[model samples]
Target: MAAPGCFMEHIAFLEASDDPAATTVWKEHITDDESEGRTA
Candidate 1:
């Protein structure tokens, strides 16, 4: 019913997060590599 559909939408939103923490970690790694004169 409508409740199940709403629940699925909520689950989808949670799963869709691009994970900012993970992105920040990746950017930091790239920055470190750049400082070391390496490519990302």
Candidate 2:
């Protein structure tokens, strides 16, 4: 697992990007991990 601060920074970077697809994919990946009881 990533350090919490690093994870948040990565998320912020993704959100700041112009690529919606990348952000959407990242969100979906996080959702899937959560559903499996895994930490992002």
Candidate 3:
């Protein structure tokens, strides 16, 4: 329900994230150990 080309951006929040892409965090949360192959 917002205007076109305009939306709330959460980059500030994400930039402060411990897991920027939420990749590893989600993997660990779901008990998937495969994230060990990831490179930062």
Candidate 4:
């Protein structure tokens, strides 16, 4: 795959839905956007 142009474009995918490790990352992301006054 081609490299992403921006730093935020970099992504590491976790396929398991119930995985505990990815939970906090996703929560942090959502909270960050909410704190910044943005939407999904």
lDDT of 4 by residue, 1-40 (tens): 3223433335676566786665646523434455455767
Each prediction's TM-score against the native? 0.22, 0.22, 0.17, 0.23
**Position 28, candidate 3: lDDT:** 25
Question: Once superposed on the true structure, which residue ranges of model 4 sit more than 4 Å away at CA?
Answer: 1-8, 18-40
Pairs of colliding residues, candidate 1: none
Positional deviation of residue 35's Cα in model 4 after best superposition, in angstroms: 22
Better of 1 and 4 by TM-score: 4
Q: After superposition, how far is residue 18 of candidate 4 from its true place, in Å?
A: 4.5
TM-score of 2: 0.22
Clash pairs (backbone) in predicted model 2: none
Candidate 4 yields a Cα-based lDDT of: 0.51
Q: Kindly indicate the candidate among 1 and 3 with the higher TM-score.
A: 1
Instruction: Select the stronger candidate by lDDT from 3 and 4.
Output: 4
Please give the distance, in angstroms, between residue 20's alpha carbon in candidate 3 and its true position after superposition: 1.4
Flag the better candidate by TM-score, 2 or 4. Answer: 4
lDDT of 2 by residue, 1-40 (tens): 5543344324444457687775665433455456446875
For candidate 3, the clash count comes to 0
Question: Which candidate number would show the highest lDDT if scored against the true structure?
Answer: 2
